[model samples]
Target chain A: MKNNNKKKIKIPKGSNILEGSRAVALTVANIEPDVVSAYPITPQTHIVEDLAKFKADGKASYEYVRAESEFAAASIVVGASATGVRTYSATSSQGLLLMTEVIFNMAGLRLPIVLTIANRGVSSPITIWNDHQDAMTVRDAGWLMFFAENHQEAVAQHLLAYKLAETLNIPAMVNIDGFILTHSYEPVIIPTKAQIKKYLPKYSPTKGSYLNPKEPMTMGSFARPAYYQEIRQSLQDDLSNSIDLIEKEYKKLQKTLGKDIATKDSSALIEYYGKKKAKTVIVAMGSVVGTIKEVVDENKEVAVLKLKVIRPFPYKQIIKNLKNAKKIIVIEKAISLGNVGPMASELKSALQGKTPAKIYSIIAGLGGRDITKKKINKIININSQDTNKAIFIS
Target chain B: MKEIRVHGRGGQGVVTASEIIAISAFKDGFFSQAFPSFGVERTGAPIEAFARIDTNFIRTREQIYNPDIVIILDASLLGSEAVKSGVNNNTKILINTTLNPQEIIKKYPNLKNKQNSLLTIDATGIALKILGKNLANTVILGALAKQTEIITLKGLKQAISEKFSEKNQEIVKKNLKAVSIAYDK
Candidate 1:
């Protein structure tokens, strides 16, 4: 007799220095998704390569498909997800832009697929480098977006993203800064299979949402103007209502990993570092948060409020954290052309009537440009006074 | 924290060398990071990769503007201006070349009076002899382990074994022998 319960699987413990792309790929493999369909792209290439190797080596049991283009890759995952299976795919920059149509359709159908965005700069001159512009393009595509600050967060967030997406039946996008996070290697703690199994069980779609041949139903059908607005409103409401579940899953993960990663607030969306009463606060996301935290550690008067979850925006928490600061500096990698930085614009809207802090928008580290500690200090020193336009740090 | 930058050609395993150094550092109970400078990668083009080792977690993602140690995997790259940009008076440089360090310095007058530690080893000579290929990455890694002592020779060998065993076991034994020969030199 085959005794499945007696079989032992040795999981990796302690810390291993892993590149961000490889780390995320290994995490996805461990989760044991049903299908992994992806096309190769730079910076994002290592991820799919590693996953393909895993499948080839028999380390993971999943149906691996090599799609022809990013568009086909996204469509394949969507089709696989409609058959009631956990599916995944990754893309960046132009590849991501090519998949925009399928991305919108997947989110509209409310499929619980998880996609990784190795955030890269959209090109005219052609750059295979790090930035948030690729992800910022799909900010309103109805996907739950989360940015990782480091390799550890990159691994942790993928695990959390799968669980959250499955629970809410909403697609999730895990963004890791290209090259900066995807190529860079760092020590990360990988949880055991036993722990993951306890947290994330086998994929079983919600009661009647999954497609069945016996009970065929149409999804993502065109609706009249009157019904379209209501459908959009329902999606917005579902995304807004996911806050509680996101917080719950974060708490559950904290318990499983035996680490304190969640914020003190009920909504684990905002992460504040340094002094609570800091007069100046720097707001940013993704790998740049590491630099900001290092500077905040050295200076007593400055603090950093890192937004882990960027989609739901956490308007109340953002205002609450930055209300006391006299100066708010929002440093972002992506800027909305002819307007302000996307994150800065959002921060300004969040603090419209709530705080009296003077906001300064600074754009840095675009196209793989290095954001050193010295440059961060320079920004803090020079931007003490108020400015109207966005400061371009060259 | 100690920062090391490696200079080589695109097909010379520059990025893999950095990754091995980082893995060795991790094996020795230190936190490490390795990454290549983002560039248009093409065979025979000049390339650079970086690695950092520390007792604590490293947070900064900036390129190493001032490297503590610089390893030149291709002697031909010594003529490029990028090779000399980040080196300082206190930097230790390890070059893979057939000529002696003093002779090379004499040939290039610019390197005559720099207050830096310059060391040279015929890594190609050794790699061609042992591995039957001109892959000097592991040979230079052994010399680096000996010069910096950031990671022990055993740790480097273990990391190399882990990486190479995935493809072929015979290659692992040959590379381990190459590391020992380079360390002795």
Candidate 2:
């Protein structure tokens, strides 16, 4: 196994065919998690099942739990973390919604649990495809949300997320493109077990207050209205400050690997392809990012700012990156219900109080709607003002 | 800057094939990169995967245009519009079909001017015959090795042996035979 890694760089080496679910399992197992729990849901089920297999195979040591519901799953990880042990769990649209109550609790208590929101469309009519409403429903749960641009990012972010969560003492939620990145196959360069172990300093919880007879302590107690606000404010402060911790962990990863992660460092302001002198730029994230790059290349002078870090929102970077653009289009995979795409609204925040450029809203790929490179090129072709009104289902 | 396109549907092992092919090139002492296009479509949906192999680290992160070679695992994708997205003067198309290489090239005039190293192997047919399933990956891969001469025959065999199951080893042997048959035909 040692010298097998030394083979040439260009020739394709061996590959273990894996779905998105398998990719998640292998990453968690490599992290050597202390606790694993999650409720089975489509697309999300394979992740937990693979984790259980890892536990049974004794390939990794951990207490794997088949929780009754997503709520219990989140609470279980929180409880495990308060005991000063690293823990993890995952869920899809409905299941993630069910865990929203405890999700806030996990953050308030500063438990470092990493969970997956396979980003499914939450519905009254019932759809299992892809959307961000499931995660957007709990966007304010005080948990750090990171959307994966692809399965490789989904896998890479897990390792980084665990380290970040542990560093900041805050839980992390990774939202993957449901059936898109989850079910699809991709060439992911998984860190070796030893490499992962070396890069990730084993998670050590600094704060430990357990609810038990021997060391009995109240984790969440009833507080007066005034005190509640103070605690919530502190929680908010901790989460916002966690942005630093997130970057710190990512920087450490870059030092060890040499390539900077888009989610960390100066890679925050999205990306563009084609001629740098282009007057138009479109910004987006996730797997569709590959499409944008392709379109920009085919139609020169088109650039894109691909957002890898969505939590901190990188306002200054967004403004500076697109200052010269004639038209800035913000495309989104998940719509904001009544308004436009998530990126569209974010573009508004980044552009406010500044010399404004023509900003457009292109909403598409909600519930896994197909957004092709051709469609993106078409969007760029549309007149400058057409962007003011939201373009849905592109 | 050589581009290689891989054609297949979801669950057919095209992603794995590209990866294995890329890694095999890397093992043979060349620079390589492989990634899936990861379309939003579901299982059985048409998909495209790509790889760049050279004597040095790849710089371009864009899709293959003016590909040096195109590997089609499922010949059925010939009907899809994406098939014509980037066929040019120098493109070499290796499709897995029973039809003659010249005949398939004749039908798609865009690819006619270029060399159609079309390996008319019913790889899907061979995979079903040997694996008892529709995994055209191994069969298509064997054809890729023989046609491209980019990697050694032993290297391709070793790569497949590393990935396939015990039962599929026999399937691999049949697939290799199918590839040899495709190469000669």
Candidate 3:
């Protein structure tokens, strides 16, 4: 009864089939951050638990702080980051909501703290599953957000997130689909310590950015009416300008690692797959893009534009990618209540008067509902026949 | 691509079974992915996990709606509606039970057919005899390897040994014995 087909197989070194949360955690540990503060929440609990295990096993040398609450966790990282040390934390759903006040402060003060938002559904009836609602809630919190489409990207993006955050002095959050990405196990190539050292050098803070007791300076100060608008505007401008820096680091990573880590288009923030001139293109973020790509590969008429970076919303790249398409379908895991999906609304506004493609918004996979290939194909079929402004796939 | 769905209650190592299958497939030079249902996680609650194995990379993140193979770790869950869903004519049912395969086919008349294959193994009994516990996940995996031929028994043994390498060597050997016993059955 034994499997007669058994043969000798060699597992390649440095490659492992790792859970997405564990991959991200291991990547964070490889970066050798100074401190990690976190509180356990469903879907996100494994991340902090893994980090704690890493510390216990002597795999990492960072100070691990088990905070009382998400708010306290956020505060602890902020303090750690302000004192000129690389810091990390992760949360989801209510935890992300609880840390909202500190989330803003971390960005407002330009603390360069990196966090992982294991994107989950916001609760009232209570659900712990995949959705973008949690991350979308803090879309305007001034933190740069990057959505990973899979476990490999989830690991690679953490290294990129830390590099980008420290380089720009802006807080960065990597949004991974809770349970979907966080709980899933897939093969990933983890960067070695030597590779990390060569790629992401030691953290040396610029003089004005760090909170040194020797040269004490005020941060998160109360701005007067005259300076308030300017401060907000400056943050906005800096976020927008970060696209260049983000692309630069991505390219540098490609050169250093000798692999194309980012999208194929060196300059584009959005990754396009399928025929470039396909009449119909589906636009999405996070893990859903994987499913879309599978369907897109089968259909010659369909294409996909995956949004890698959500904040500093890649308007120009998105518009450019969809300009020639006759139909554009925006799939979202979260709805904006009274309005359409947050992403769909943004896409519509970005495409206003810019492209002739009729835009359709489809809200699917809310609170852990599966977005199967059949559902995606159905959406494509429906959108092809006639334009639907907002269709809820239940 | 081969998709598999595992049904068992919480604390039954259902997720671990899927992971081991995936790891075994990976060890055999195939791309594999595994994930749990992430439902209410209370112990004894019906939980499911999924696995996909293919020659090429698996890009889709969707749950396996039409699994080629379904492994039932808990025989008590056989009558549940959740276990009945997504089963088609070509689906293979591998259950950890002492009942005969024909008996199971007769019990679930809707699932019986000429094309479909229903398999049963006393994995729980084997686990209790060899490992002194009711951990049938690895034993069921051995039966799955024999039925599907998706991963080799050698691959499964390697994965099981590596998984329990941190634990006592005696325990790892006992688990391997359980897998061997279930495979022979």
Candidate 4:
């Protein structure tokens, strides 16, 4: 009977075909967060729905909370984490924007929650498509942010998110390009339960931070002007300090799950591909990185720098990788309204005095507009050294 | 890498058909990726889904600008602009219609002079006869497997069973039969 039961529940060892959302949901199940709460939104809907179905089918051992709104969903996880247990939630686009107030609160409260942002464009004319605008909106919310380039990385990053979040006692959000990564079906190898358990153990919060009736401690209390600045400074310092630990934990995960399962880099913060001496280097994040990689392979003179981690910025790493390039092109999906592309602005700021390479900001694929290979090829051929304006590539 | 684009109406399992192709390719020991075109979907509205199969890992996530093969699940979408968008002279087209290839060429003259390979099968009739419904997505895949050597019928059967495994065993049986019947045609 034991052998039969084990055989029935055994997961496939190598890569299995799975929809991206289903893969993420299965990873979340393996992590076995104490509570899972979310409000359904496009692209993100499949993930939470699968989690709920898993709970209903008795495949998962977590509290699945159905919330009325994204605010309520974010709040539910915030409240759940206050009791010192792992919690998770997911949302996209407008749904994420609705959780804005609580999102800031979750970070300030320093709850180690894991949230998945199926990245999408914010509404103007209204769209339910893949973009980075949604996650870019929360770049300053004090949460550790990571973007995945493909389904395999998406699955591995979720495991890494819980580890990073719990260790730093800071919330983490993994950004997956909505509909692009969320809706795509690909061959991905989800790590086994034993592997994930060995990599990311149960969450153990600090004794004094959580709320307990017996040892009653105050959390999220009001701070006067005297201490508020110091509190903000500490959060900033800790986030920037996590740069080293992120790489360390990623290497340990690679060793635990085998290097083939996770990405090859010792530092999962950024992935660099193509020739070391390539004159042209393209920098981007999210699913677009995959497309760039394909293009980079065809064009031998170009390279790609995939930004996996957004917050804490990875300033030194970006400079180290792009220092020798003659031209650095930053193609992105979102902008700061009046300012340049979110990532482009950061690159300009990071590489201002360090490197002599000119940075070009090109925006494409907003509101799910297709960034075809032709468009990327054209962007690559742009010999113009103009770095002043953001070029909207059609 | 081989890219395929599928065109059909909403609720016609267009996405599911692409996913099946991807899964079948995976079962055949190849890397595959499939995704739906980002759109505001509604019942009976035109929609598109894409799949790519390769001996190595598929890295690109962009929409398929030029497809190697095109599958149409509904005959009504045969000559639609969306159907003709990415197709080129080299594209092999499979359609779910009762019309023969000559009849199809008569209706759409542009497909006549091109080097495109056009294959037509009554997938809807097969599906309706076997499954008692107009769900021609899986049925058309059988024709796809017959025409193009991209994926095998055995892989398609396995993919069908795995996809519908969560549902009634009867559904899995009927879908497999529908695909098999369409394959024989």
Q: Each prediction's TM-score against the native?
A: 0.94, 0.77, 0.95, 0.96
Error of 1 at A107 (Å): 1.5
Tell me the lDDT of model 4 at B65. 76
Estimate, for each residue in B37-113, the C-alpha lDDT of model 4 and write its tens digit: 96446899998999998766788888887899899888788767788776788888898889888888788776776
Model 4: CAPRI class: medium
Please, what is the whole-model Cα lDDT of each candidate in the order they appear?
A: 0.84, 0.70, 0.85, 0.88
- Ranking of candidates on TM-score, top first: 4, 3, 1, 2
lDDT of 3 by residue, B103-155 (tens): 87677665556224777888999988888889899999988888778778888
Error of 2 at A133 (Å): 4.3
For model 2, residues A36-135, the per-residue Cα lDDT tens digits are: 8888886587788888987887787999988888888888887787777888898998898888889878888877889887778877778787767687
Tell me how far the alpha carbon of residue A92 in candidate 4 is from the true structure, in angstroms, after superposition. Answer: 0.2
Per-residue lDDT over A182-241 for candidate 3, one digit per residue giving the tens place of the 0 to 100 score: 888888877877787877999999877788999999788999998999988888999998
| Model 1 per-residue lDDT tens digits across residues B40-70 | 4578899999998876678878788898888
In candidate 2, which residue ranges exceed 4 Å CA deviation? A1-24, A120-133, A150-152, A183-188, A192-199, A260-279, A297-300, A323-326, A384-388, B1-118, B122-137, B148-152, B165-185
DockQ, computed on Cα atoms, for candidate 2: 0.15
Q: What is the interface RMSD of each candidate, in Å?
A: 11.5, 8.2, 4.5, 9.7
By TM-score, the best candidate is: 4
Please tell me which model should have the higher TM-score, number 2 or number 3. Answer: 3
Could you tell me how far off, in angstroms, the CA of residue B17 lies in candidate 3 after the best superposition? 0.7
Q: State which candidate, 2 or 3, has the greater lDDT.
A: 3
Instruction: Locate the minimum summed-lDDT window of 10 residues in model 3 chain A.
Output: A1-10
Decreasing DockQ order of the candidates: 3, 4, 1, 2
Model 2: which docking level applies?
incorrect
Evaluated on CA atoms against the true complex, candidate 3 attains a DockQ of 0.53
